[model samples]
Target: MRKTATTLADGRELIYFDDTEPYTSGAATRELRDRRDLDPVAATSTMRYDVLTGEWVTLASHRNSRTFLPAVAECPLCPTRADRPATEIPAEDYDVVVFENRFPSLARGAEPPATDHVDGDDLWPQRPASGRCEVVCFTSDHDLGFAELPLPRVRTVLAALVDRTRALSALPGIAQVYCFENRGEEIGVTLGHPHGQIYAYPALPPRTEALLRQSRAHHARTGRVLLRDVLDAERRSGRRIVATTEHWTAYVPAAARWPVEVHVAPNRDVADLTELRDPELEDLAALYLDVLGRLDRFFDGVGKLPYIAGWHQAPVEEGRELGRLYLQVFSLMRAPHRMKFLAGSESGMGAWISDTTPEAIAARFRAIAPGPVPS
Candidate 1:
């Protein structure tokens, strides 16, 4: 893949990952100039410490005015055309492009307040939400989704993600990086475009922290990697296993809280995407596409299911040895034409109640899978 980085009209960074013949061979080049007149990005978000949970809550008030669902003609994610107003991407067409988010929750240039405490209270500390957020356009075609992308295109997208993860991890004050996709209106996706997001956080997220604690405790007790042990147990049981490749495995977690949840983990220990070998990455592209396809077919007559797919990577400076890379894909759809809503038990308290068992979910997935996964 050939990566070309450029600056947007408003000074934000935009990158193109070209994998096609002309672009990749250097016979042609991507349009580097963004000619549209755009306002400067002013990131005024702040991070407030949640005393009760010990987590940082980013307050991006400006995001309230972000672009919502728009008509196809006015979709900002579409490639810019001469006949139409310019969109976010200035190129006439692109294979895969990534740009800094216009409405970012955390920004690299955010300014913190003079005082550290909120209203002189030591319990509530506040700081600038200094980090990065980028949008990855899976395909220029708005009608196409990630699952429908061709194998080469999927590999290109994966390359872009790996590149961003490595670069974002090196940024100042970035403790952890997260790459995720939120699909469907039910999942609160504002745009109809097939895209994902990368978040470079200033601190480790609560989920990462929890995973680290558990892994550390497990290592102390058993002298073995926690996730590796879990994977071994799942493979031994084979009850919750959905699919397995030479370098990866997909299974429904034993304690899955969602109605439909699957965890895809690499067979070998890898802390992050950057550590993946070429063969592993290739296997990942195929296995991930296969899993996503099954998810769409999970509930008959449901059409495209609303789900969230997130990458869990280790922190840049902490828990590197114990961290294990994995992908968690889950949906809110419990049945056809029905959705699962997080109510009192889930929303109020930090507890989850599963509507279905992991074994049952795995059985359904196996039934829909297209036989054994390719070796």
Candidate 2:
């Protein structure tokens, strides 16, 4: 599966890649293909990369128009429909359910083009597009967000994440697992359900790839994990520490790119939370909940605040201990009621101009005493 150009209805080019098709039998692909339980389902999502912007897009074929604004009475992700057919799941019985996204950004089981590369000055090799996109529903409740769920329930969600990570990482072509949640309509969510998507890619993303290069360089010289040392320094400095436990710490990064960006990283050099022992899993979950609770209290429970949360870890090819696993949450609010906008520098030049300093964001988060568990 390699990327080839396809034209969208709007006449823009959409680069398509189908992972199920053979591309290169590299080490990464071999590992990914072996994970049968989690590989791309028979009817998987379609993926295309944008040639100009270098952004990957997923288009899932299983999703129909009706799946977008489903009524509460017809919510299929709810627990009551565990045994229901694929098309008629009832809503309301599940604690956590992992399913194929109804309207996936990536369509499954697509066929890669026989030849995607063309002789042109602007052309680069299109990487094979193979991977799985899954939505993990956190709860069966129609209106409950992660912050509104009980502590134990939230723990279940985290555990599911770890499980899915492990399952997907074992597949043949997957090079990385990207997990994230986009909350609120401000982030352009088409559904009101409390769920997040997991993407198992055949190669590392550009940002992750860059981080890997930096870490490899650092390790070649210092024989230490860059993130591990950074976590230690941040703990000793204490300027940005939000909360710390035996296994995890939440703090604001000194080089934060957003106004209210909070990160929870493992004190040890664990690539992803999936590698944590059972006991450590609970600690990671506890720390995650602690930070989220703080965020909820900061916003006064309106739940209208928009935010994005994503996990950053070393690529699967880098081994499980190459980098410390961390979660970053960035709030869209830059001022009391105003949202931050990405103008010329950010949108056009790929440069970020932050309005708030990391130190100030850290101080503000520190001032808010950790409130009761969010639920």
**How would you encode candidate 2's per-residue C-alpha lDDT over 115-157 as one tens digit per residue?**
4443322343343356667777776566877766776666667
Off by over 4 Å in 1: 24-32, 371-375
Best by lDDT: 1
Residue 289 local lDDT, model 1: 92
Residue 221 miss distance in model 2 (angstroms): 3.3
The list of candidate 2 runs beyond 4 A from truth reads 1-76, 79-92, 118-122, 299-304, 318-321, 372-375
lDDT of 2 at 243: 82
Model 2 scores a TM of 0.78
TM-scores for all candidates? 0.96, 0.78
lDDT of 1 by residue, 1-375 (tens): 788887888999988898886773122234436788899887899999999989889999999989999998998999887888988988888889999999999999998877888897999999999999999999899999888888899999999999999999988789999999999999899999999999999988998898889999999999998999999999999999999999999999999999999999999989999999999999999999999888888887775889999999978988878888999999999988688999999888978887899999999999995532221
